[model samples]
Target: MRELKYLNKYLFKYKWHFLLGTIFVIISNIFQIIPAMLVRDAINYVVDNLNIYQSLGQSATQQKFFTVVAFGIMVFAGLIVLMAFLRGVFLYFVRQTLIVMSRLIEYDLKNEIFEHYQSLPLSFYRRNNTGDLMNRISEDVSRVRMYLGPAIMYGLTLITLFMMLIPFMFHKSATLSWYALSPMPFLALSIFYVNNIVERRSEKIQEHQSRLSTFVQEAFSGIRVLKSFNREAQSMEKFDRELDDYKKQSLKLTKIQSMFYPVIMALIGVSTILTVYAGSMEVINGNLKLGVIAEFIMYVNILTWPVTSLGWTSSLVQRAEASQKRINEFLKTKTNIVSEKDLVREINGKVEFKNVTFIYPDSGIKALKDISFTIAPGESLAIIGTTGSGKSTVSSLVSRLYDTRGGEVLIDDLPIADYNLTSLRKQIGYVPQDVFLFSDTVANNIAFGTVDSDQSKIEQAAKDADVYHNIMEFAAGFETRVGERGITLSGGQKQRVSIARAIVREPKILILDDALSAVDTKTENNILNSMKRIMRGRTTIIISHRVSSAKLANKIIVLVDGSIVEQGTHESLIGREGVYKDLYEKQVLQEAEEKTS
Candidate 1:
């Protein structure tokens, strides 16, 4: 209930719909109670007139009386039918307003969660799994909607019916009313007990559901690996265990829920029996009419369904509360990276890392340690390193994907934080080491960074990345779908397409973090030649391990264990007997050996 308080804003947002729905509920209940009253009057009239009919038997006067009585009964029947029809009509209106409002709120909440997810920093993603994030927006939101729609509808109906029926029953016969309502307090206590258990089980069920979803998602995403390793049986056994656990939890909840209706029915049965027994005694004592007893029974029957539905409504509220709490946890998370300035600046691409140090927040691994470098506008710098030597971290800082933990990262001589975040990122073309492409056409993937890029630009960028002929060889050429994460394309083609995506943007600062690793030497050289033309007046940072790529840069820096050990021109680095020189010699020897073989 406390967690559900978060939905107050949404409730207020659709207050008009809620108000109209409430009005409909009231009207429906009014129509609902009128039928019982009509039945009461019809019965009383019929019972009272019985003796008069007997007295006038076998005469024209008797026939006239019978005709009048028959007509009166028909009129009561018609009015009862009319009341039922009107109740149904108002119920329809109630669903249209209340249920539709719930759907609208669901839509808004999902979008809000999605937008917040997008705004969160990369570290936040590292801290959370994809399946859990997906479940919060989808499954949890659906649960909250149940509370907003059906629970609210039924709960209101119960209150309205109770308010109308209870007073009417008391006004007619207080003793009969008390007998009929005697079971209500016990019913409430039973529901209270069940609700607590339901809430606890609902939370457990949701948590287990998230784990199951994550397991399935990961299994499907890595199906190829599973098949290759021949671990299908193991995976199936694990899935079975999760499924069994889910079943047990669900059954426990279902068992409790299953008891609810019977208990309510039992209570209702007691109320009915009590009303009949008490009313019979009053009638025998000549204190109450048979018609009043019938009316009280009708009232009790009217309340039966609403009272029975209390358990269901309570369960929905508990589930919704659990889900909303999960949703609020993520919504309350404040992103560490935010734009300090709203002014969009034109980037000249002078990137500088001033004694920067950064640690991965999730792992607490120091990726960069007191690293400093400058790439002047239109100048190309190559960072060469062994695996895990912080080459990629430099590129990440230049793009402001992360903020420095210790020192400052600057663009155009101003702190990168001072620039509008969107403007700064839009001007930098960053191709990461592990490339990712959407399940889309090759042309679309290439043109993704630039929303309005023409086909000519896409083709030109593809040619520049040395992947144009490869794409042309496909049956659909540039229009071919790349499948999930560009699975349809080869590794080299995917990397090249990623490069074309960045190229299409025509960003001022271009950082290729091992973007050409999958391409052959000949293809790499051709792409480098094209890049030389593109890099003439743009700042470029080429992060790679191969000397062939680094030799083309105007300056080269060698990294070792998260620190830069050497920095010089390519020719100077080759002349010196250092880490860079050794790497260059090793690569040259490997290329020669490959050619000989």
Candidate 2:
């Protein structure tokens, strides 16, 4: 019942259509049950009261009996057909409305979840699985469709039929009605027990379903890697184990269901027998007529269907509740990054780190400690360091992917947190170490962030990134679909496409986090020259491990152990004979040895 609260608003919003359909059901069932009652009256009239048949001047007693029975049969058949037609008519309209409601709810829920994803911190995404996130938005939203359709109407039908059957049963014999109600308490208890089991089993199924989705997604994504390393068979064995676990869990749930269903049927069968025996005694003792006994039997059969619906509905409600629990858990979690209200900032690429300190969540010590720096407009700077020297962390702060712990990262002389997130991101283009491409055209991939951009702009960006000629050589040219994550493209091509996407944004602050590492020397030089030409009046921060790449910057900052150790032009850094110079000599000697060989 608590799970229903989330759906109440939508139910009320579409109440008129539901009420109309319900009215049709009520009318149809009323006409449908009348013939059953009339059968007993007609039979009793011919057997016990022949005066009415004689006064009508039909025929002798035997002929009148056949005539009356034939009339009753015709009436019953017509009413049954009419009821069936009404059921079909209402079902069509009701299902149509439900389909619309389900689609609307699905769309709104997906948008809300996507908005939440956009607001969450990078730390959240780093910690969570991508496949789980996908399941939350796609599969979970779809689960609500059944709730709006069969589950809801079946519950309503069960409740209404239960209320109506009591009067019909008591009309035939009060003692029979009381006896039928006797088995209800046990039925309710068993339903409650099975429902509890269903909840646990359903939760297990959902958990394994998410794991299966994640494994399949990750394995398919890295199929090329596994094949190249000759680990395809090993990967398949792991997948087979997961599939077997899923199958075992599914069978356990099915076994529980199979047991619960028979228990319900057995309890129902007991009541049916008792009802039949009690009604038959009433007829034999002359307290009830034979025709009335027939009506009682019909009512008992009708009661049986509602009982089955109750048990079946209980199981469905339990499964839906389990799914609701997972969905609600996702909805209740708050994002670490919150947007400022109605905030926007015009950017000119003056970036400052003011007494900043930051620590990753669930980690000890700060990633950046008491760090402060300032970069003027149009200046190009390079950050160089060994792995985990706070170089990437500092770049992430500049892009406002995360907030600082102690102080602030200011852009355009304003605190970054004060600016609208979208506006701020629009002005700062960032390409991380791992490039992501959608399954779309090469032109669409390049012009992703720009709304309503034409093909010329995409072509220009591709040319700037030195990838235009390669795209032209493809069979479909610019319209060639980049396979999932651009799997069909080479690593260098993927990196170039990612760079082209950022360059097309025309950002005021451009960040390249080892984005050119996949390309050769000639291609990297061409892209560097393109940036130099177009980056006027904008700040550019390049992070790289290669000394050749850092040499293009006007000034270089070398980080060691989360602190800046050297900051100067390449010529000045080499003259100092420090860590930067030592790294430079090492690379130069390696290149010289390769050339001599």
Candidate 3:
């Protein structure tokens, strides 16, 4: 219930809609009750007039009386029809305002959650699964919307009907009204008891739904791997097992929810019986008119639908509470990686790491240990290391993807945190080892980072990355669509296209983290030659294990177990008997052996 209070701000945002909807509820109910009163008066008028006409015994006066009675009945019927029509119109307005406002809030809430997801650091994604994150924004929000739209609408209708109808019932006959409403307290108790169980079952159902969604999403994403392993039958078995569990939970909820309407109808039956019995006794005693009994029955019937809806509206509210609690859990999380300063400054790409040490938050492994380095503006530095030697970590720190645990990372002589986060990232073009591409055309993928990139600029970047010829050979040329994660292209082609994406950005700092690993030596050399032109005045850091790529850098550093072992020019490092020289010699032998074979 407390979690539901978060929606109050959204409600306030669309206050006028709610206010108008409330007015409509009141007016519609008024019109609804007026028809019942007219029915009561019409019944009494017919009873009174019948006796007079019979006493006149078919005279001219009796015939005149019959004419007047028919006219009166027609007028009453016309008025009743008009009231019903107006009530329906106001009800339509109620739906337009309240339900439409809920949709608007749903739109705003989803956008807000997605924007927050984008602002969160990379480590947050590592901590949470993609399925759960998606569930919160989609399925969970839909449940909350039920609370916003249908539950609120029905709840308001019930209140308005009760306030208007109950008092009139009492005014007609206190004793009879008491008998008619005697079952209400019992109904209230039943609802209270069922609400708790409904809430618990709803939470379980939501959890299972998220699990099912995650399983399906992962299974589809890795369909190629599943088929290669011939695990389709196994996957189907797992899905069936989960589906059975979900079915059982849903059935339990439905069994309980099914109890609502029967109980409401039974109670309403009891009210009807009591009202008839008491009202008939009053009429027999000449204390009340017989027409009043019909009026009481109509009132009870009018209240019937709203009373029965109590269980449904309560269930909606309980489910919404459960879903909103899940949503708030993520919305409350504050990202640690945020810019301390708002000032935007141009980056000159003088990146420096002073006594920097970093540990991965998700897996508390220290990736960098008191490492120190500096790459002056317009210089090229290549970091060479074996797997898990903190080579990629260096590139991430340069991009400020993660903050250091015990030291400072500076850009242009200012702490990285001082610059605006967006501004800093915009000036750096990074091509990661594991490349990902959206389902879009090849030209669009290359021009992804540059907002104003034309077709010529995209083609130029593709040629510079040595992927132009391959793209031109495609059936659609640069217009060819790369499937999910660029599955339409080969490994080397994907790597080159990613390089083209970075090249098009024309950033001040370019970090290539093993971006050319998938290409052969010939293609690698061609890309390196093209990069030499692009890297002329940019601060570049090339992270790779191959000596052919490392030799192009102005300076080379060898990283071993998160510590710098050697730092010098490529020629100087090769002359030394250290980690760098050993790596270079091994690569040289491997290449020679390949040629001989």
Candidate 4:
């Protein structure tokens, strides 16, 4: 059986409900046992005398034999009806309490995991798949629920039946009772073996399931690219390979489960035959009373159900234990980023990188090394670099998405470690290169995290992002759902909506990390102009390779091999004729050559 120690906190929360449910089960279990004892008593009464009236200690001359038999029938009927009613009541509440408790556990566990995931650095998501994380919170949590709910009540029922049965068996016939229970140890050992196999098979199935989900998610999210590139048949073939592995795993689990029933039935068949045959011989030899034999047979029936259930419960408990280990492992994983106790919320957007060095979590080569720079408030600085030149790494530090291994990132001359994450992030407005939006209205998406954003404020942000007129043209206007990841909207629309979200935050610093990469020059210029109009007092840091965007910044910082190669306005950088100047000349020549062609 799984030790649910980690679940103690939640169990304590719902202790009262479990207590009431347990009370009901106990009452119902004891009441059900009364019918078995009553049957034995009635049989004993019949055995006392040949005359039906005198059998139960009634008057000998009395002609009330018919009435006595009828009264016995009535009493037996009442006991049966009462037992049925109580059992029904008990099962209902047991299910009720367990269901409620399971949902609560699921809610807390998933939410807590989400909170933990939020606290973790970006490197965690880079190492793990989004689909796998979703499955762990959704499917894995549900698996835990199965054990806590229906499985618990079944286990409780088995235990209660065992307690009531042993005493009754001892009283019936001590020698026969001992003989009847002699095979229990063998049964238990076999169950353990069966459970071990089931657990191993179940683990493989879960692994396959996660792999399948990941494949489907990636393919579906990139369906447009796949279709445009004519990779449908190729994608399908890859998906089938993953699905085939999943099918094999499922089949293996079923095969292991299939073996359990036969083994259980064989043992139970042996026990039942021994019980009946042994009791019959004793009666024939005049060593045991017939009433005792009858009662023993009835008790054997009661034991049969629990005996069969042991096999099933063994499989369930093993699966639950495996799931428990998996959940514990997830819970134990520590976040890469650590928050300090002295963190405050007093940043004024003066970002400083002091001899900072950072490497990806799984990499030996440093992505950024010996980087040092400072940007004052209200200054617009541009970062231009080749792919993997640590441009994004520097941009991410401003949001505390990655912690530097050497030196420190400071805001307002204080180390970023000194500022609380929530307060620091609130001061910065960042629109990521990959735009992600939920399936919700444009208004809601724009005003996502703003507490006091009314309709007018939402529209103002939209207008500033250069997406207001476009959103108004949709069939449902601002009420239209964006579809999954904003798939219903065009690429430019998605980018601008994300910008609108950042605009409404009214941040002290604005970061456009390739945010306008998807749009054409005309649309990009319009969005940039709108942004420039509203960003007078705030520090704007734009990271882009496009010289047009870079030129707009009052100051430009160019990076190469994780170090600043040059820092100046566009005209000054052009005057120096370095890396940035060469790149700018190449892009300008390419555009002129395209126009001539």
Candidate 5:
């Protein structure tokens, strides 16, 4: 019942269709019961009218009696066939309405979940795996639809038939109806017992399935790394372990589910036996007519099917309940970042971090502490640091990827949190250290940042990134498809294309986080030369380890241990004999050694 609360809106949205479908179910069942009554009437007519030959030894009287009985039998048979046909027609409409409604709901639910997924903060994705989320949206949603469609449909059928048949059964013979229904209490208890076991096992099965899916997705994504390290055997062993676990869990659930049928069949079998034996005794003792006995059997048979179907319907309900719980929990997650009521529509490219501190949610370790800096509009500032010195974290904070723990991050004299997330992000273009290019044409990937951009602009951006010539060398040129993660291109090519993607946006604030690490020295110099003209009116923040890259900035900051240990021009920093000087000398020596070798 708790799990079903999440589905209430969809159910209510389509309540009219469900109501009409339920009416069809009731009407169909009403038609379905008429044939049994007709059978009993025909049998009684045959038995009573055939006694004409015994009473009057006239052939003419016997012929008339036989003719009347035959005519009555034909009429009953015709009505039975007509009733069966009508029942089938109503059942068809029932399925068309309710089953189709389930599909409609499924479509809407999938879109809602996907939209919610898009709106969630980045921290939520970090804590959750891709495969588990996929399973929840795909498999769990389908299970819920099954519950809404077939489970509810048949459940209503059983209820309506049970209510209608009880009084009718008593009408034929009260004593016989009691005997036939003796096993019902035990059947209900057994269904209750099985349902509990099924629900628990179903939850475990779904959990194991999510783990298995995550393992496969991660393995396939990292296949190149595994093969390079020659660890295929180790990976295969791990996969086999996961597979075995999944199989064991699935079989355990199957074993429990398989118990449903035989138990139900046994209970229903007992009821049938009692009905026949006790009914036969009533006929012989003259307490009940044979026709009434036959009618009683028909009623028990009608009840038999609904009782037996209880197992299947209960299983569907239990599984759906388990799945709904998982989905509802996911939907209830609160986004860590949100826009304030006073939303700023734009920024003037001036950025500041005032006594900012940040801790990663997963590690709970401070990535930055008391960091303060300012970049004036149209000015270029370079950040140089060793690994883990919070260089990239500074860039992420500028974009408001993660909210600051302690101080204010402002853009254009307003706190960053005061701006709408989308509007704020639209003003900044960031290129991360790990460049990701989608599987698409070079033109499309370059234009990804700016939707519906013209071809001329895309070409100009590619030329600015200094990859236009290399792109032309390909067979399809800009139309060539870059495979997954741009695997078809070299590392330098991927990096340049990613830079072009950022450039095409023509942002007010451009962040390059080790964006030139993969290119050669000459190419890097060329890219920097091109960027100088482009960076004239744009605020640029370059985070790099290379001295050549950092030296081009108007001002340089050297960070060590999440704090700025030095801030000056390259020449000033070199004269001070600080960390930046040491880095410059080392790189100079390494380049000289490489040339000599």
Candidate 6:
């Protein structure tokens, strides 16, 4: 019951519905008890008539006796039918109000969790898998619904029945009721034990399910690699291993549940036998009437279903408690980055990194260390670096994808943290090395960053990215669907589409991290030439390994091992005997050698 406390907010939201549904539940239970009482009354009437018939002997006509018995039975049956009908009506509304409320709450919870997931920083996604989060939001949420809806409703029914039946039973025959209910305390203890085991097993089952979902998602996403490597059998074997674990856990839970039924029924069986034996002895000793004994038996029968349901309801409660705890743990996670109060909402694209340092959340090694640089508004700077030289890290910081640990990332001379997160991100356009495109139309993919981008704007961005001609070649042009992650398109096509997406936003800062690496030098040169107008009055940062690309920038910086080693114009760097000079000479020689070959 304490586990249900988390649902207080939702319950309060739908308080009126619950109140009406509770009234229905109470009325239905009350009506249900009437039929049993009617049965006792019917039996008593038959007994009284029998005694009168015995007294009348020869004077009582056969038809008259038959008429009296039929009349009494008919009256009782009519009352029973009327009560049952009333109960059904109330039960219908109980389901309508309570069950529907649960669904509404489920809808709210699912949307809330998804919104929170979106609000979380990128580091959170890096540490968690999609499948595990999916399982929590789907399966775990459904489990909580069971507790909120059916469990609460049925638990209330059982409690109401107990309150009504017990006192009546004691009034009829306290001795018999005492003897019959002696097994209840033991039954309760058993239920307690069962619930504990159920809670533990339910958690394990959910965990296994999460692991299985993750495995399948990863395998399917990487199916191309598995096929190329000819590792189908290996993948199948791993999947089978996880499947076997899931099967074993499921069976263990079933085995525990199976043991519950017999233990419960057997105790109930013992109580029934004792009540009958004691009542018969009392009748023989003239301490109780036969009709009273029959009524008590009917009451015991009514108790059977609710008592049996105790095991099931407890199981629902235990599982829900476990799932709620898991949901709470996820909701408690604090985002690593948070925007400050009263922050600026506009950006001028004057970017500066003042002695910044950053390390990944999990990794102890620093990604960028004591780095410092500034790019004025409307200026383009190219960063050339070897693998892991912190080139991409600089682009990430400009967009505030990550926050600096040691120093400040400033936009328009204010710390980046002093701007609203939404405003800052809206001002910068970032294109990463690996581009992700949804399974949507080409036009939609290009216009993804903006809400109201029209056809002309999409085409203009596409033309600037040097992809408009290629798109026109497609069967349906911009309307054609790109497959998952733009898999149907070539690497160069995907990169161009991604560039178009960023350009359509008309952002103040554009950061391209190896974005043009997939295209040929001719296409790269053409795209850069076309981007001149778009890049005007906006800061642009190009991170690339190619000297051909870097030579066109207003300024160029060479990085090695997380620090800048050289900074100058291409001609000035070529004049020096340093890293930039070596890189330039190698690329020029490689091109000439390739042409000769």
Give RMSD to native, each candidate: 2.4, 3.5, 2.4, 3.5, 3.2, 3.0
* Candidate 4 lDDT over residue span 227-336, tens digit each: 99999999999989998998988898898889776877776667767767787788788877666655665666666656656766666655666666777777888875
RMSD of 4: 3.5
The lDDT per prediction is 0.90, 0.76, 0.89, 0.79, 0.87, 0.85
Steric clash pairs (candidate 3):
none
Q: Quote each prediction's TM-score.
A: 0.93, 0.88, 0.93, 0.89, 0.88, 0.90
lDDT by residue for model 6 (339-456), tens = 8754856677788888888887766568788878889999989999888898988987887778887889888998888788888888888888989999999999998978989999
True-structure lDDT of candidate 4: 0.79
Predicted candidate 2 versus true structure: per-residue lDDT over 1-597, tens digit per residue: 686577677677777656765665455455545555766675575566465555556557658776776677677667657756765676566555555565666677678778877777788787788777887777666666456656666666666666666777677678877776677667767766776786688789878887887788888887788889999888889889888988999999998888776877887777777766877787788787767755665665656655656655676665666666667777777776656654776788888888888888746557777777788988888888878878889878887778888888887777878788788888887877889999999999998987866788788889888899999999999999998889889999999999889888888988889988899777888988887776667798989877877877888988877777888999999999788998899888986886688
Off by over 4 Å in 5: 52-71, 191-222, 225-260, 285-294, 342-344
Ranking by lDDT: 1, 3, 5, 6, 4, 2
How do the residues 1-597 of candidate 5 rate in per-residue lDDT, one tens digit apiece?
689788889989999879998999899999988888888788777777767646766678777877777888899999989999999999999999899889989999999899899888778888898878988899899999989999989898899998888888887778898999999878867876887787777778767777787788788888899899999899889989988988898898899879887987887778878888888899899887667666766776777667656766887887789889999988898776887855857667998989988888877878787988888999999999988988998898888788998999988888888888888888888888999999999999999967768999899989999999999999999999999999899999999999998888999999999999999888998899999987889999999988889877889998887888899888899998789999999999998987788
The global Cα lDDT (0 to 1) of model 1 is 0.90
Pairing residues by index, what is the TM-score of model 6? Answer: 0.90
Off by more than 4 A, model 2? 1-4, 15-32, 38-69, 97-103, 142-149, 184-219, 224-268, 594-597
Model 3, C-alpha of 251: deviation from truth (Å): 4.5
- Tens digit per residue, CA lDDT, model 3, 484-539: 88989999999999999998988999999999999998899999999999999999
Model 2 residue 555 CA deviation (Å) reads 2.7
